[model samples]
Target: MKILYINAMGPYEAWPQAGVFVSERVAALRKNGVDVTACSYYQINSPAVQRVVTRNGGPDLGTPIAQQAGVTYGIRKIPNGFFSAAMQRFRPNFWEKRIARQVRRDMEESKADLIHLHWIWPMGLGVMRYCRETGVPYVLTCHGGDIYSDMKDMRKRPYILKMLEGAAAVEFVSKALLESAKELGYSGKNAAVVYNGIRTSVFYPARQEHPGKTVVGFAGVMILRKGIDYLPEIFRRIQELIPGEIHFYMIGSGVLREEIEKKMAGLPVDFLGTIPSEKLAERFNEMDILLLPSRQEGYGCVIKEAQACGAVPIGRDVDGIREAVDGFGSLIAYTGDDDAFISAFAEETAAYVSGEKPIDRAAMEAQAARCSWEERQKDSIAIYQRILGKAD
Candidate 1:
């Protein structure tokens, strides 16, 4: 089957980590003998876009663009400068039209049997319109931000609902996300809960030799949505209880890094800015515990990544996170309750440090196995086949 995958940003663009996930999914589908082509807009101001412009001539309008792995990319340059900034601030639809025109051109050239849209914001409206007009089937996947934030905007809700109404199938990364869509009055057909998976080959367990030290770590974007601001107080309480026995490591970067550092001043925390994917397994293995205190998570893929390396995850008891840590790790209080969260962290840390509670390497591995890319691929392929009326 010829399939077209549409996303806002992937590996070589604005969000490289998300691009890695998309690359893995495409690789898995190709391995199963499916023909998949991916298309993404050129993310303005991203390092990857800068590199592309430096190496190749900037993207041309209405042309078949670059290729990565086996997937073809259609790159379009959006309007820049003061006028573009005004359009973005006053009329976001101006940008969506450019996205739609490019996507329509790409779809016409590829003649794909199906389209799978990754997120439902600017891209979805355009792609869904093209699919509706051209009589092609497309599936929409709500990957966190669209459902959590974009859908909350009154101006965007109608467009979002129209996309859902037009899609052949709608996939959510977690059950919590599916419920959120429903609560927003999305009475769509053929909805499914498909959790994001980890590449086990890259994220599996390793033998660590850190002796006499319990390392608690946080991995992912250090943004407010991640509840990173609360880390300082939590760490302070942990240190007050078990000084010198525990150490903190944060493995990622974002806008709030400086503020987080300021709050965590004089603490035992080490900021290990962003680590590459190749070395992530080693970092995960180094941690005795991985903390994911997200205020709102779609599906914390890092939770599974850390667990694959045998780092027990302790996360907030919120939507998608609660499910990710259900059978594998500990769930503390909700995002804002610092006292309850601190109490839970201190208790769990004390138990692990004192040898009263042991890290179950076997159990963590088992959970990771269930959430691996191979398993996710199986579900995704089945969804594709079902949508195509080719299911056995």
Candidate 2:
């Protein structure tokens, strides 16, 4: 069966590291003789776009390069200027119609059996429109921002809900997100939870002898949602509990980076700036702990990656993160309360520091190893087969 995998956030060639997760899934399916062709919206990485894009983080939308994976895909550039970019802040109503047309054209030309859409957005709405027109089925995967952040807009809520309800099947990265969708008014019967996996080849236990203080790492767009604002309080509490016991290294850049850096000045923190995904594992290897005080998540991919690299995971006891840890890492502070978050961090790490319950790096690696792209691919293909009624 011809399978079309659509990524709304990428032209994968430019997204490199982030793109690898999708490419790995495609490659795994390909190995099983399942025909999967991936496609993405080509981002125009110009100076004007850079101003907006970097506001959230660094150039995650890097320059589009030639596909080095030896597999070609449908890569269409977003044909819009500053105005279109500004307007698409809440919904891509303008250029999305053209993209929707492209999705239909791609499906028709490829004779695709099904379409796998990454984000249930404005783009997913377009795909839904196409599916209704052609009677071709499409699966929608709801990543974090699409549901949590996008759903807040009353104008876009109807479309997101429709996409959730109209999907041939809805695959949520975390069970909490699935429930969130249902709470937000989706009575869909055909929904499932498919946890994300890392490329094990690139991420694995690689800890060396680092004899200094315990190095804690934080990676992702530094913003309110990621709990960047909690840094000062969290750090103060951790230090009060275990003085001079931890040092921090932060990755990714965002609107809060400068303010956070300034606030964290004179502290044992190093703002490493935004590192590429390919080299992320190297940095993970240097850390003894990975701290992600995120208020929200869609299956903390970074948490798993850190676990795979032998870093003890520490984060909020929230939705996707809860599943990502899978009883392997340390999770505390259920509420967004600063004191509770701080106490949880201290309580969770004190044992390790005191040698009462020291970190077992090997076991952490094993947890991550248990579920990977290979396993996720099998589950995904099974779902696809079920959807298409293809026993083969």
Residue 351 in model 1: lDDT:
68
Per-residue lDDT tens digits for candidate 1, residues 26-120, read 77777787887776755354454445554664421222245443455565544345455456556655566666787777777877788888877
lDDT of 2 by residue, 166-258 (tens): 878988888898888788788859898887778788788777655646666688877799988877766666666664556778887666788
Q: Each model's TM-score, in the order given?
A: 0.87, 0.86
Sliding window of 10 residues with minimal summed lDDT for model 1: 57-66
Structural RMSD, model 2: 3.5
How many clashes (backbone N, Cα, C below 3 Å) per candidate?
A: 1, 0
Compute the lDDT of residue 380 as modeled in candidate 1: 78
| Candidate 1: residue pairs that collide | 11-19
